[model samples]
Target: MNKLRQHSFLAFLCLILILPTLVFGECTCDEEEDGDRNKTEALKYKLAAIASILVASAIGVGIPILGKTIPALHPDRNIFFLIKAFAAGVILATGFIHVLPDAFDNLTSPCLKENPWGKFPFTGFVAMVAAIGTLMVDASATSYYSRSHSKNNQAQPVENGGDEEKAGEHEGHVHVHTHATHGHSHGSVDTSPTTQLLRHRVISQVLELGIIVHSVIIGISLGASESPDTIRPLVAALTFHQFFEGMGLGGCISQAKFKARGVAIMALFFSLTTPVGIAIGIGISNVYKENSPTALIVEGVFNAASAGILIYMSLVDLLAADFMNPKMQSNGRLQAGANIALLLGAGCMSLLAKWA
Candidate 1:
């Protein structure tokens, strides 16, 4: 009887250990299956995103360019001012609400080593340095072009200014003197059409660079995600995000009035960047871990830099230039309209942040 009882107790102990092992093994297999299924679903959503975003970007940018054919949408028209104001607001919100926060999140992620990343506010520091660098580039470019154009203006006679060559020379001198005085007084003001056009070109190109950086980062992120639920909502959110951003870029491009070939190239480049980034992400997804130290640092620094460029361009080049214009200041109705449009643009972009 005693031997039988001891044997029974040993059997019970074995059962207790074996039962948990069997249950855990079954759970591990189920988890593996679920992970595979999620990856498959995510791929499908990523493909859909590439297509939808491409279409949305094309339409958004095309609208402003096509609007140039309409009289009311002319750059000089009041309606154009309102449209530009709205676009500027969109850019502002993108920098502050979308890009800047992402930078902070990435830089401060718990996955990074606490010694360096956690010890310093790298995001803010990088962003501030980037902003200063952009300002330097902006000022230097403007000054160089201004001087070049001023020299050309001095050397060449105005077509309608005078008759005799001596009169032309006198007129050129007078014009140069006047421009120099104006520039000195206003601190880099150039009212000539040629100079204005050059500024627009520079602004458009720089703005595109800023937008493209953020676009590519976001695309890679969406593509690398293995969660179908996360990718699904992002598809819609990013579509709107790209559309509005394209509109902002389109407005600048239209104002620059690039030749047909140039315009097409710029538009095509903007439209393709995100899709290309997605492809890259998909190719590397198997090896790409978002929480890795290298990934966090790279994404965080790039995001911070892009945010700086966009914020500077939107506030200094776009909003300030337009809002402080004599035309806007002189007319109360136009001012009100532009203000409303700006708010609406910003609010729309900010709302999209909920999903993206």
Candidate 2:
């Protein structure tokens, strides 16, 4: 047993030391002004990617919001379960296959000093901590909202004993209104909307964190690179990636039942943040070093945190919530279909990791 533990510790330490070496190994010292000159050509193709992503995001997010118009897409239907499962799979793959791997690379890079980093796996550790933090936020926020909503229901005060019977009857139908309308369900009618909204809000905020962290890191790397050939394919890949990610996030926001203004604001934030990061990267390219110790550490820590939040949100709030629901459990065929869709979603996203 002692031998096994020691072997595990040494193996883990080796991974920590080796991984970051790969990430920072790609670094090239400062480039010339000609690097900026290459930007004009790169800009032209990137616009296409940006446009494609924006359109995809709009469509993905808007589709889920139209449950009223699309009967088959309604939350109660078996098809809706399949779609949510597929989405959850995509999110899970994003966290595990894409984001987590990238975080490991960032922290383990050769650019950073070896003494302390070589001793421990801070990348995985940070991700674990971040995931825990997100859970706390999700649970505490939901509890607070439920408590506030409970107060509101109590203050309404039943007008008469006759209305009391009506209230009881209305409560019976609350179950029907739940699962079909909100992304989440609550045991008590008073806490339903609050619980549902809190999850959506938490999802939107955390998803943004993941995308934003990756965007800035990639943007800086792109800005520092002099090779137009490398940047060309990345522009296309990242655009598609951003679009799909935005769609997943948008779908969650729509189901969250936020007001129209709130919805638009969130969608806009997701849309604009990456481009803004890219622009910032362009501005700071002179001072920015893709191989710098400080840059690697900052980017690694943030990426690890984002990966943790995204992984947890995808698995717990997105996948588990729907897959384990009574609705899914009651239907055997739907569960099978959803399982296939989940694999497809995860597989498709994992393929993208090759380029972007």
Candidate 3:
């Protein structure tokens, strides 16, 4: 009886030792096979995403440009204000709902060290700095252009000014050179057509830069992921995402009134940015690790900066400029329509955050 009991104990110990190896070995093999399958499916989805996103972006941007032929879509028309309001709302939601949270997640990831990343709110700090920097650039550029334009106007010979001065002198009144008459004022606010046009051009370019930065990061993330389950819904969400974003950008570009060559170049560049980013991700997927410290920091910083720029542009440049306009403020119906459109645009983009 003693020998039988000892033999039973020995068998139990042996089974315990061998069981883990057998289970773990089978799990490792299964995991390897699943990883391979996931990679294959991911590549197929990535290819499809690139094609679909590119087409969606092109169509979205094209709509605004084509709308130029429609009388109601003219910039001076009330309906155009509604469109701009909606586009601004989309951009605003993108910055607040989509990019800012991602920046926080990346900066505060567990993969990073706790010393600097965890101790301080680097995401908010970086975004604040970026917003300030954008303001500086915006002000500086506008000031510089205003000065240059003033110089050019001053240099031009005023053909009829001499006659007016003579006539004023003969009437026993001192001739006051009021630049307002020439549509270019030296002091006070200069709301001339030329100045406004230049401002639009600058705003459009800056807005594009912000949008492009965010688009690239998202594209790379989507491309680098090897899980079809993750990529599947993103394909649909991002398609809608790019489409609305393109409309916003297209509205800005149209307002800038660029020449044919410039318009085409800007349109094509915006259309291709996401696909190009995806292609880059595919090329570097073998070596790129999304959770690596370096990748996290870079992506986090860029996303924060982009969020700042987009938020600032949408609120200050796009919405404020139009919403505060005398025309929009005076018309009750137009104001109501614009407000409704803005709400709809923001609601749609915010909903997309669930899937994206």
Q: How much lDDT does each candidate structure score?
A: 0.86, 0.70, 0.86
Tens digit per residue, CA lDDT, model 2, 102-206: 878878997778888777999999999999998888778777766675566557665557454455335322232324344654465434544566666766676
Whose TM-score is greatest here?
A: 3
Tens-digit lDDT track of model 1 for 17-115: 899988765677889899999999999999999999999999878777876687776788898889888888988999999999999999999999999
Better lDDT candidate (1, 2): 1
Q: Lowest lDDT 10-mer window, candidate 1?
A: 167-176
Error of 1 at 241 (Å): 0.8
Per-candidate TM-scores read 0.85, 0.78, 0.86
Give candidate 2's whole-model lDDT. 0.70
| RMSD values, in order shown | 5.3, 12.2, 5.9
* Alpha carbon deviation, residue 156, candidate 3 (Å): 3.0
For model 2, the run of ten residues with the poorest summed lDDT: 171-180
In model 2, state the lDDT of residue 265. 80
Ranking by TM-score: 3, 1, 2
Alpha-carbon RMSD, candidate 3: 5.9
